[model samples]
Target: MSFYLDHAATTPLRPSVVDLLTQSLLTQGNASSVHSFGQKARQVVEQAREDIAAAVHADRNEVIFTSGGTESDNLAIQGLFSSRNPIGGVARPIIVSAATEHHAVLEPIEWLAAKKNAQVHWLKTGSDGRINLEELEELLSSKAEEVALISLMWVNNETGVVQDIPAVAELASRFNVPVHSDAVAALGHIKVDFATSGLAAMSITGHKLGGPVGQGALLVSRKTKLDPIFHGGGHERGMRPGTLDPAGSSALALAVKSAVAELDQSIQLWTDLNLRLVQGVITAVPEVKVVAVDLELGTARVPNIVNFIFPGCAGDSLLFLLDAKGVAVSNGSACTAGVTSASHVLLAMGYSQHDSSACVRISLGHTSTQQDIDAFLAHLPEAHERAKSAGFTV
Candidate 1:
């Protein structure tokens, strides 16, 4: 059987989500319509919205459905920036971010800087893959008025490192600067309570949590204001314009509920599997390092993802070799616009170019089994041998 270790890219759709999607597809009527059939469709949509809101401890109206994580991220950053507005002839067009963020959050902030004259403050991370909280506090403390918002990821998708989002938000709050987090990788893996998080906005996608690929949400707290990204309809608080997909919405809602409900068990299983996989690789290779996890910090990184670097082997080579042996993984974030270059996350955490390119990420999910882990370990030694013989790519 093929072992799929790329849950950070996307997890297999859960059976419950598939069932809801199929049932909703068989029904008819636009949720925007006012007729009986439309009202029924609207009910389904609202129910899904409520479910998602409850999962994040947000208000029903605060959860705005979008196409997926990328769109949700764009809406949060662009919306918050546009809404922040300049005061008394000065522009508050500065976006504060970290180098370790996913492309979804980074791209929008970069776009604003390049085209719209927005200034970006890039935060640095330590070797542990954790950003310096004091750095963030200093930036916000110096000129809180000039800052639009601080966007950071709740977790590093490629490295599986969890950021202390609440701590970040608390610091930002002192300056009255809103914080938006890309929680795509953190949603199902951690206890994410947006209400308690003190965050102005948060983004999450369904596929990462065992729902369909297209559905996602941006949780904007009622206290925060956001300008519309798409301007045709008043739907989703005018933040996003499009006809609602009841099927996708209900499916995603069910997926979030199920994931949150089983989070404790899921974490335990993944923690076990990660330790097993890491130990097996290190025992066999003796020269590889699983970058983020530490004996002191324990599972500070998410339980599913384990990133390791082979000293003399290219990451892409190891990836290909493992794939040939029926194990699937990634050299870095799958959302890197198809580039196989070294991970920016590792580089930000202080790895040199050559060392950064030597990494592979193995992420687990609900469908992963001990047998699947065993099969991967069985193939890893041979794959590492082949990759090492091939040597590093220039």
Candidate 2:
């Protein structure tokens, strides 16, 4: 059997979610139409909106469906920045984001800085992957009004590091700057309540939580102001305009609700699986080091991820070797997997190029089992040996 250990990339759609999608696809009419069929489709979409909102503890009107996380991130960042007041008749919007954010967040902020003359302040993180809150405070104090928005991921996709969102939100609130968090990784793995998070907006994707791909939503607070990124038929309150996919929305809501309901048990199972994986790796390969193992559990991490720095082996080589042995995993983000470049996230965490290139990430999900972990551990040492023989250095 193939061992799939790359939950961070994308999770398998739940069987229940697939059933919901299949049934919803048979329903007739566009959500935008005013006819009876259209009204039925519209009801499905609105019910889904309400379900998702309830799952995240937000109002139904606050959920604006989008294509996926990337679109949501762009809409949140660019929309907020464009809506900001121009400084001295020029748009001098500032964006403060962590150095460890996914490319979806980083690339957009970079575009704002390079093309829109926006100032970008990148918050540094320690080797443990925790953002420096003091640095954030300093930046906010110096440039509060000028700062348009702050984007940070609630969990690091590479290392499963959880950011301090409440603290970040409180800081942004003091300065009246809107905060946007990419909660894609944190959605099913953690309990995320928008009512308590104090964030202006958050991006969540469906595929990350056992739903279909190409569907996501931005949780926009009713009080927060944002301009439309796309202009068309005034769908999603005119913030994101297009024909809504009722099937995708229904699947997303059902998946999210199921995940939320099982979150506590899922967290516990993942924690157990991660502990087993870490311990098994340590016992099977004495030379390999588990990165950031000393950090307190659940304090800095999500329970499902275990990232390791394998000495004397290149990450890609080890990954391929494992693939040859019927196990599949990733060395870095799925979005950037084909590039073969060193991980920027590991580099920002103060790892050397060698260590960064030698890193591998194994993320688990609802379907992970102890037997799967054992199977992976069974193949790991041989994979490491072959990777070393192939002349790929640590």
Candidate 2's displacement at residue 205, Å, is 0.5
- Deviation of model 1 at 121, angstroms: 0.4
- Assess every candidate by TM-score: 0.97, 0.97
- Candidate 2, after superposition: displacement of residue 120 in Å? 0.8
Q: What is the lDDT of residue 270 in candidate 1?
A: 90
Question: Candidate 1: what lDDT?
Answer: 0.88
Residue range 1-394, candidate 1, lDDT tens digits:
6989988899999998888899998658899999998988999999999999999888999999998999999999999998897445327978999988888888899998887778999988899888889888788778788999999998888888889999999999989999999999998898899999999999999999899998999999999999878888789987888888889899999999999999999999998888788888889989888887672222467888888988888899988998988889888833346567878888889998877989999888889888878988898889989989999874
Q: Estimate the overall C-alpha local distance difference test score of candidate 2.
A: 0.88
lDDT (C-alpha) at residue 285 in model 1? 89
Per-residue lDDT of 1-394 in model 2, one digit per residue for the tens?
8999998899999999999999999989998899999999999999999999999999999999998899999999988888774436434478888878999999988997898888888888899888888999998898887888999999889998889898999988998989999999999898899999999999999998899999999999998888887898888877999988899999999989998999999999999899989988988778886767777667678988878988777899989888988898889833344668677898899998878888889999878888878889999888888887785543
